[model samples]
Target: MRPQHRVSARIYSVSLRCAASLALALLVSLGCSDEARPKAGAYCKISEEGQASACLAPAQHAYPAFFRGLAQDKLSDEQAREVETDIAQGAQSERSYEALSTLAYGYYRLARAASSQGTADPETLARLEHWNELLSKAYASSEKDPRYREALRQAAVDVGSRTPPLGLRCTDADGKPARCDSTEAVVRAMDEARDQTGVRGEIGRLFDRVFGTRP
Candidate 1:
C-alpha cells in the first residue's frame, strides 16, 4: 500500500470556501452548452469545443455540493464515499489544470480531517500519505503554470495548512540520497523527471522521478 498509487475511480469530494466556489463557477463558465455529463472514462477526452466542457461541468459543480454536504453532516458515510469516487475519477479523467487543482484541494481537506481525528491507524496513515501524494501530483502537474499552481496552493492554504509534507525521499542526479524536506523541495524533485515535450507526460514523469520506476 504505497501512497502514490492512483486510486481506482473508486474514491473523493470538496468544500464551499470562497475560493472553491469561485473555481467551481469559473469551470462552469467555460462551457456554454447544456450537454450531458461524461461518464467516468470520457470526462477528460478532448472533444470538439462545447462537448468536452459540457461533459465535465457536472463534475465541477458536484465537487462543491459534495463538500457542503459533508460539512453539514447531511451526507452519510456511503454517500460520501460514492461522491469521492466520482471526484477522484473525474479529476483523473480530465487531467485539466483545474481538475488537478480541485483534486489537490480535496485531498488537502481529507488530510485535515484525518489529522483532526487524533489517532493514526494504518488506514489513517495510508490516507495521510495518499493525500500527500495527490497534492504533490497536483503541484507538479501545474508547475509551469503559476496561476494554476498558486490558485491550488492558496486553496490549500485557506484550509489552514501552509503546505503538504509529502514525505518524499530524494536523490541527487548522481544517485546519492537527497532530502526533500519541504513542499517546494518535493515538487522540485518531481520536476526532475518532467517531460516538457508533452502535457500528458507530467504525472507519469512525476511518478518516475519521485517514486522510482514502480510509482
Candidate 2:
C-alpha cells in the first residue's frame, strides 16, 4: 500500500511539472505573438533618419516621440538637421495646424534657451519672430484649440517681463494689427476667445487635462 502511495505521489509531481511546462510555453508564445510585435509603420521600426524625414507626416504621429527623443539628447547632429529640415518644410507647405504649432514651439524653446544664457543673438531674435509668425498661423488655422491661445497668452506674459520687448504681433477683433505688448492685453484677448462650453472646446480642455499641457 505504501508503494502504491509513493507511485501516486510521483505521478502527481510529474503532472505538476507538465502543467508548469505548458504554462511557460504558453507565456512564451504570447510574448512572441504577432500582436506583441511593433507594426510595420511603428515609430520604433523606423531608423532615426527615416523618423526625422517622416516626422511631419500626419499619419506618423511622430512629433511626441521625436521631440521626446530630442529632449533626451538621443538624436545625432545629422538626425537633428533632418528633423529641422522637415519642420521647415512642414511650415512652408502649411502641412497642418499641428505641424505649424510644433514649428512655433521649436523656435520658442530655442529662443528661450538662448535668452537664458545671456543677451539674445540676432539669430535668437529671428527665431522669436518666427515663433510668433508660426504661432499666429497655427492659431488662425485652429482657433478653437486652447493650446495655441494659451501659448499666445504665455508668450505675451513672458515677453512682457523681458527688456527691449519682443514686438510680437496679433490682430484685434476688428482685424486691425495689434501689438502683443502686454500680458494683460493678450490674456484679455485670449479670454474673449475662450469657449470651453462647446464640444470642440470641451475636447480641447479634456486633452489638456490628460496631457497636462505641453512643455
Candidate 3:
C-alpha cells in the first residue's frame, strides 16, 4: 500500500477501536446502574408488563413526579432527577410552592410506605424533616390557609400506626360546611371549595404577581 493509504488505514483502525471501547464502557455503566437499582420484580407489583420499574421508582426516589409518571406512562430516570433538582431549587424560594408541596408530599408518602415496611432509616427521617420545613414555608406563604393546613396535617399521618381519624374541616363552593376523614377527601373538598369561591383565579393572579410571566 502507498504510505498515505497506510496512514489513512491506521487512522481508521484507531477510530474503530475508540468507538468499540466507548460502547463497551456504556454497556458496563448501564449494567452497574441496573444493579444499583432495586429489582422491580422484588420491590414492585407489576401493574402492567413494563410498569414494574415505574411503580418501584417512588419508593426509591420519594418524588411525586415518579408516582405521577407511573400513572401517565412517562416515568424515567431523567424525570426523577429533574424533580429532585426542582425541589432543591424551590426550597430556597417562597415562589415555588407547587414544587415544594409536591416534593414534601412525595417524601411524606414515601416515609409512610417505608414505615409500613419497617425500613424507615435516619436518612429518610432527615429528608422527611427537611421537606416538612419546606412545606411549612409553602403553607406560611399562603397565609396559613385552611387548605394548606389540612395538607400538612394529612402528611403528618403515621401510616405505620393504626389509622387515625382524619377530621378535616372545610367548606364547599357554596360556603357550605364540609368534613372529610381522609387526606384525599380533604384535597377534593378544598378543590371544590376553590371552584365554588373562584379562589383559583385569585391564586393565578397571585402567581403572576409574585413570579411574573415567563418571557
Candidate 4:
C-alpha cells in the first residue's frame, strides 16, 4: 500500500474502533442504569405546588409517572435508590413537603403489617403533618376548592387515626331549630341541609365538619 494510503487506513481504523468502543460503553452504561428501566418505576409527574400523580414519563432521570400498589411493591433496587436520591438531593425547600409525603407513603407501605394494615412507625405521623401543612396552605390559597376541603378532611382523618366525626351542630342557616326525623342526627342534618341548600349544601356541611355532630 502507498504510504499516505496506509496512514489513512490506519487512521480510519482507529476512528472506527473509537466509535465502536464508545457505543459499547454506552450500551454497558445503559445496561447498568437502573434509573431508566421500565421494569422498575418512580413517580415524577407533578402539576401543582402540592399535587402529585403517576404518569409514564419520557426517558428521563425523573421517576415514573404512576404505578399500582403491586407495581410499587415491585420497584427495583434502582427505583428505590432513585426515590432515595429524590428524598435526599431532589427535595429542596420548595419541594420538601411533597417529597416527605411521598417518602412517608412509601415507608408506610413497606412497614405496614399485612395482617393489621397499619404502619409500623408512628413517625409517619410527623411526615403526614408536614404534608397536611402544605395542603392547608394550598386550601388557604383557594378556600372555594371543594377538593381542598376534602383533602383537609382526609388528612385530618389519616393523621387523627380515626374517621372524621359527623359535624354535630343542629340549626338552619337562619339559626332556627330543625327537628330530626331519625335517631342518627348527622344523617338527619345532611338530609335537612340538602332540603335547604339545594345542590350546594356545602355551607351546612362545613359547619358539621368544623363543629362535629352527634348521632
Candidate 5:
C-alpha cells in the first residue's frame, strides 16, 4: 500500500475503534439508568397490545403537556381547567398515586400563580384547599413506593421555598375562608401527611395491596 493510503487506513481503523468504545459505554450507561429507575406498577402500565383505559390515557398523554404548559406560562385558564377535569376524572376512577400527585401539583401551581399576582381569588382559595386534600391522598396512596414518596417530598420542598401571598386564604372545614398565610404551614402539613402512620397509613397500604396499583 502507498504511505498515504496506509496512513488513511490506520486513521479509519482508529476512528472505528473509538466509535465502538463510545457506543459500548453509552449502552452500559443506559443499562445502569434503566436498572436504577423505579418499576412501573400495574396502574401505570399500558398493555403490550397498546391498550389503555380511559382513566390511564389522560395520565399518559395529557399530564406532561399540561405541566409543561404551566412551566412555560402558556396554558390558558380554560386549558388548565380542561386538563384538571381530565386528571380529576382519571384519579377518581383509577386512584393511581401518580395521577393523584400530578393533579395535586397542578393545583399547587395554579394556587401559586394566583398568589403571585398578589390577590387570592375565591377560585384560587378553593383550589388551594383541594391541593392540600389531594396531597394527603397522594402521599397516602404512595404506600411503600419510594419513587412516589420522593416525588411528593421534592414537590413540597420546591413549592414551600416560595413565599406565599400576604393574604393567601384557604377554606376551613366549615367552608369559610381562613388565612393560610405561609408556605411554611403548607410544607409542614405536607410533611406530616407524607409521614403519616397509624390507621390512615395502614388503610392506604391495604388499599394498595388490594388494587395492586403503584405510582
Candidate 6:
C-alpha cells in the first residue's frame, strides 16, 4: 500500500488586533435573547446577547464565558488578562482529557491576549508551551479515541500553530486603500488564519516582524 497524503483545502485569513479597539467598550448585545436556565448545564446554550452565563459542558464552560466577554468587548485588556490567569488554573475531572485540554487552552489564550498587548514574559511563554504539551497529549489520545479530537482542534492551535492561506490586510498611512492580499500581506494574513482556524506556532514566528513576540 502506498503512503497516504494529507490535503487541506481550507482557506484562512490573517487578522490583527483591532487598532482602534482600545477604546471600544465591550459590545454586549442583549438582542435576540433567550433566558432559559438549563437544568444541568455549565455553558450558555441559549446563544443570546448581553453575555453567556455558562457552558453546557463544565470543561467547556470557562472558556466560553471568558471568550464571550472578549467578544462582547466586556472585558478590558487588563480584565481579560485576569480571566486568562484564572482560566489557566482551571480543573476538571482528574486525568480527564477535557480538563487538561481546557487548562492548556486557557494558558494559550492568555498568551495570545497578552501577546497582542506586546506583553510576553517567561511565565507567559511557559504557559503557552505547557498547553502545547497538553494538546499533544490530547492529540495522541485522540488516535485511540475519536471523541478527544474536538478538544484538540479547539485548544491546540492557539498555542502556536500556523493556519494556511492567511488572509492579511495592510492599511497604509493615508488610509486611502486598505489592501487585502494573502500573498503580499503574509504577516497579517497569517494572524488572521490563526484567528479563524485556530492555527498557531509558525504563524507567530512568520509574523514576528509585524506582531513582535515580547514586550
Q: Highest TM-score: which candidate?
A: 5
At residue 102, what lDDT does model 4 achieve? Answer: 48
Segments in model 4 whose C-alpha atoms lie over 4 Å from true places: 1-126, 162-215
TM-scores of all predicted structures? 0.35, 0.32, 0.29, 0.26, 0.42, 0.32
Q: Which stretches of candidate 6 lie over 4 Å from their true place?
A: 1-53, 60-101, 157-215
Candidate 3 structure quality by residue, lDDT tens digits, 111-208: 44545656555444544444444444434444324333333333333211222223334444455766433243333433333333455646634544
Candidate 3 runs further than 4 Å off: 1-101, 144-215
**Cα lDDT computed for each candidate against the true fold:** 0.43, 0.46, 0.43, 0.38, 0.52, 0.36
State the number of backbone clashes in model 1.
4
Q: How many backbone clashes are present in model 6?
A: 22
Clashing pairs in 3: none
Q: Which ten-residue region of model 5 has the weakest summed lDDT?
A: 42-51
Maximum-lDDT candidate: 5
RMSD of each: 22.1, 13.9, 17.5, 19.8, 16.2, 23.0
Candidate 6, residue 16: the lDDT equals 25
lDDT of 4 at 52: 35
Model 6, position 170: C-alpha lDDT score: 39
Sort the candidates on TM-score, descending order.
Answer: 5, 1, 2, 6, 3, 4
> Which has the better TM-score: candidate 3, or candidate 6?
6
lDDT of 6 at 200: 45
**Which runs of model 2 end up more than 4 angstroms from their true locations?**
1-105, 143-197, 212-215
Q: What's the C-alpha lDDT at position 138 in model 4?
A: 38
